[model samples]
Target: MSNADSSTKKFASQADLEAKKTSFIKLSDNAYAYTAEGDPNSGVIIGDDSVMVIDTTATPLMAKDLIRNIRSVTDKPIKYVVLSHYHAVRVLGASAYFDEGAQQVIASRGTYEMIVERGAQDMQSEIERFPRLFSGVESVPGLTWPTMVFEKEMTIFMGKLEVRLTHIGMGHTKGDTIAWIPSQKICFSGDLVEYEAAAYTGDAQLEEWPATLEALRAMQAEKLVPGRGPALLTPAQVNQGLDYTKDFVTTLLQSAKESVAAGMTLKQAMAHTRKVMDPKFGHVFIYEHCLPFDVTRAVDEAQGIKHPRIWTAARDQEMWHGLQAG
Candidate 1:
């Protein structure tokens, strides 16, 4: 595909991407999810005297929609902005929240380290890969900095409401987390649980991802706002979303394993996995953008490679070529 077609394939056009601000659904009396038309999800929790936001959108301009939605509800000052991981698409709009008087921006220790180590590289790579998502690219100052960092788990109370944030291991990334509201059995599952969209595993810990999902399942969330797709209301829909994500991970790893057993190259292994996964999950958002990277990482992991290597712009183009040929 030409670069123009490639760009269109990956990024949703600004005109095509409609941000539908939904009325806040009360997970409990204090917690709510301010979801758009699946552009990028942000969470809202009205604490005892403050409000906490989960995951700012891709750009500050895009985040204004979230801010507008927040205005519709209580006027509590946004006290905290919690990042589920370190991806720019999720955290770049953080400054917008801070402008509204957010007290501290929180992220896991691993995510904090990632911003220090590979943030610039990731910013360049993702911008070149998906232009439309980063509509106001020139406006982003740099990686969003996390003011507060945690090791494993942290608990905070908004008056009587209890909110638990836990780092559930290296699933989607080294510092993946899910915000749990115990009183309502609701979870703001970041990229750890994709409803219909393809889980981007470029920076994932494959062996540990399944166990992390299992841990999330044990939470028994009645309502969940996943990393992508609509809010899962029923228990059955939640289970289906979890199972679908698991299936994607399982299929990629198993295909890579079979290819390794047959002495196939990484390119060959990726082709095999795509052939297998497309029939099952071809229509999800960013499926093409994610699959090649997912297979490459899975193959490396299957061959006993522990850590995922950093992806530069050069590496992305090289992998895209290899996958497209198949």
Candidate 2:
């Protein structure tokens, strides 16, 4: 097959310019979800005297929309911003919250370390791949640094409400954090759990990802606000989201393992993966854009590269071109 027709299928989401309608749904009395179709999602927890935002939108301008929604209900101080992970799309919008009187930005130690290590490169890489998501990229002050960093787990009392933030194993990234409400049984599971969307496992622990999903399953969260797609309002919907994410990651890893064992090239492996992953997750949001990165990382893991390689814009282009040319 020709490279233009085969390798250059153009999964670059820059072509994805259509605007998506944003939704603000109240999952419960204290919990709400700010989602825009399949774009990045944010979680809101209105405590007795304050508001806690989980995963700020991509930029301050984008965050303004969320702020408007927050104002629609409560004008309490936006006191806390919790990062689901260190991905630029999720954390970069944190500065906007600070303008709303955000007192603290919270994240896992791993996420903090990741930011110190490769946050700049990751931020540039992400912004290049999907410019539409970063609607106000120029407004990003810089890499978001968490003021409050925790280890395995940390609990914050939003008055009587108990918001538990935990480093729930490694699926999406080293510092995958989830904000859980014990009283309401609601969870804000960053990219670790995406409903009807592709999980970007480029910075993932492929071998251990499934187990992490299992750990999240043990939470038994009745309502879940995933990183993308609609909120999983019911326990059954939560299960489906977990299942979808687990299936997506496992399929990529298993396929990469097969391709590597057969000594197939990266481009060849992507094709091999499509046979299985496409049939199941082909129609999901960002599937085409994420597949190559996911497959490449899976291949590295299969070859015993435990830590995921940093993805820079140049490297991304090289990989994309190589995959397409082959």
Candidate 3:
């Protein structure tokens, strides 16, 4: 396909310019979810002494609205910023929390390492791929570094409430973290689980993803705030989210493995994956946008490429043209 056709179709989310209505659903007396339709979702944990913000939006400007929503309910000082992962879309808005007097930024040690390695490239690549999501990219101060890093697990106390942040194996990314409230039976799963949305597996650990989901199930969280989609309030909805994400990962990896076994090229593998996955996940948000990247990573993993290739802006177009070409 020519650049004209590619420009129109590649990263076509710019055409999706309609604003999404944001919702702040109270999951528990101390926990709330700041979800905007299918956009990246954030979780709020209100503590007796202060508050904790999970997965700051995309930019400070965008986060100001979330802060406003938080203020609408409680004026507690925003004391903590918990990064579920190191994705730019998730952690870039951290400055807003800091400005609100956030005491410390928290993340898994692996996430901190990821931020130092390919964070810049991922930031540029993601912004270019989904301009609408980063509505105010200009407000992003810089790479968001974590103030506190934990190894395996860390239990934080927000007064009497305990917020357990654990590096729950690897699924979405190597540094995937989840915030669990044992008393409330609520968990804030980062990109490890996405509800009613396409699971972006561009940098995922596909082989280990299912096992990670099993660990989440072992929690039996009654309520969940997924990375995207609305908050899952009921046990059935939470299970649905977990099952949907697991199905997506397993199917993609299995298809890619089959393609590799048949000695199919990346382009052919993309087609094979589409035939199987599109029928089921085609209607989900960003399905078209995510498939190419997801298949590329799966193919690499199947071929024994352990680490995900860094996605630069230029590489994104090259891959899109290769996959979407007529």
Candidate 4:
């Protein structure tokens, strides 16, 4: 690629400079969502005696602001830090909770394995890809290791409220987990669902994702705190988020399958996928940053590559330049 073409903007999210104001929305009496425009979101679940945080922000410094928000609502200690998956942007800030007296960091077995396998590489890759999101990267001490891990599901109670954490099939990643409160019909879906923003599918299980959405819908959640976008407070809004995410995943995978069937190259598949998806999702946040990665994964899945390759900072540039140059 030419020097001008290989500028920072060509890499994923390198040129994104806008600052987004954070929103702390109450989804129910016990559940809340911390969203920032279209950035990754964190969920707060407050029970009678303690609190459980779902997905810490990108760094310890960023999580401090979330802690301040939690203090505004309840003084209960943050007893648990639940990771939805092992993404750097999602789990790196976990130590901040431990500093604030969080008793344990929790995740699924698959997520724990991912951390052991690719945590370091993903951290470096993400920090370079989205500089603004990792504004406090220096504050991240190291990989956030989970103190507790479950197989399929586990339930915990804080005073009267019961929080259900389940490995609801894989979508965004192989170890996707969701926090569900049965009594309130509320769920904290990590990266499994994105409302208005683009779904980052670089590490996704595309074929299994739609069925996972069905599993999420079966909960009949009245309130949902999605991974990105504003909190869904009503049942209708919750359905909309699920449907939008399903459509995005379905469309991308379908386009990629067709490209593969026609024996198209990766760059050609990406172009074709964009031609189909841009009209609908182009206006969404991080659509440009997400599509290249999304299509690359879709193409891989279509060609029978079940697991996504690890993305290092160097691999990210190579892929971007190769795809964009073609």
What is candidate 1's CA lDDT for residue 316?
80
Candidate 2 residue lDDT tens string, 52-89: 99999999989999999999999899999999899999
Question: RMSD (Cα, Å) of candidate 4?
Answer: 1.8
Tens digit per residue, CA lDDT, model 1, 42-150: 6788888888888988888877877887778778888889999988888888888878888898998988988888888888887777666776767677789988899
Order of all candidates by lDDT, from best down to worst? Answer: 4, 2, 3, 1
How displaced is residue 94 in candidate 3, in Å?
0.6
TM-score of candidate 1 relative to the true fold: 0.91
Q: Candidate 2 — number of clashing residue pairs? A: 1
Per-prediction TM-score to the true structure, in the order listed: 0.91, 0.97, 0.97, 0.97
Per-residue alpha-carbon lDDT of candidate 4 for residues 132-206, written as tens digits (9 for 90 to 100): 998778999999999999999999998999999999899999999999999999999999999899999999999
lDDT of each: 0.80, 0.91, 0.91, 0.92
Q: What would the TM-score be for candidate 4 when compared with the true structure?
A: 0.97
Q: Which pairs in model 3 have colliding backbones?
A: none
Error at 45, model 3, angstroms: 0.2
